[model samples]
Target: MHSIATPKLTASMLALALLLAGCATSPDFGETLETRSEQASAIAGDYKKGEKLIEAGRKDVREGRKLARKGENRVNRGEDRIREGEAMMAAARAAYCRDTGYATPECR
Candidate 1:
């Protein structure tokens, strides 16, 4: 074999085989960085969406407070109206009893 081939050619063939075996797989360093950046961007987007939803919930709570205040005012007004009607009915009943000198139809 040494008669036909030189040592230099044997060395060159070994180097080529080694290079080809080492490079069989595609380069992954650039692809790994790109995939990590995409994951980071997605995480950032999710964080922003969560913040916006929290803001919307805060706005809804403020609106609910406003509605509760309005409801309380309406209830207070209704209570005052009921008190006035009860006082008027009592006065009318008293007047009827005084004139009849006994239990009146209104008292019954």
Candidate 2:
């Protein structure tokens, strides 16, 4: 009985040893951690660059809107000036017709 138990114990010990050896052959945890750390840093850098680009794009949009508003204001002013000029021309034509005793080419 003692001999049989001894053999069984040795076999169990050998199996445990084999399992531990198999575990040791796996990839190193430190190296895997280092690789993951590098990937994270690269992702962070790209994220920062993307943020800067987005901010620049927002600034450009703001500037474009400002320029468009300025142009629209200029167009409005020009239209106003044209209306004023037309009013003046009409007044001048009327005055000329009255002063010329209706002999002006415009009155005729």
Candidate 3:
């Protein structure tokens, strides 16, 4: 009985040793941690750059809106000026017809 138990104990000890050895030979945790740290830093840098770009885009949009409003105002003022000029021309044609008694093409 003693001889049989000795062999079983030795086999169990050998199996445990092999299992521990396999675990020890696996990938090094220190190297994996370092690689993950580098990847995280790169991601953080990209995120910061993206934030800056978004802010710049927002600024551009704001400036564009301001320019569009200015353009609209100019267009409105130009239209008003055109109406004033038309009224002035009409008045001049009426006066010319009254004074000369001549129905020129413009007076018509």
The whole-model lDDT of each prediction reads 0.69, 0.71, 0.69
Off by over 4 Å in 2: 1-42
In candidate 2, residue 43 scores what lDDT?
55
Q: Per-residue lDDT for 1-108 in model 1, tens only? A: 456545543333544444444345436545454454554455556666776898999999999999999999999999999999999999988888888886667656
Model 2, span 1-108: residue lDDT tens = 458545643333544544454455546645454454455455556666776898999999999999999999999999999999999999999999999999867899
How many clashing residue pairs appear in each of the predictions shown?
Answer: 0, 0, 0
Best by lDDT: 2
Q: Please report, as a residue range, the 10-residue window in candidate 3 with the lowest summed lDDT.
A: 8-17
lDDT of model 3 at position 91: 90
User: What's the candidate order when arranged by decreasing TM-score?
Assistant: 3, 1, 2
TM-scores for candidates 1 onward, in order:
0.61, 0.56, 0.62
- By lDDT, the better pick of 1 and 3 is 3
Q: lDDT tens string, model 3, 23-55?
A: 556466554544544554555556667768989
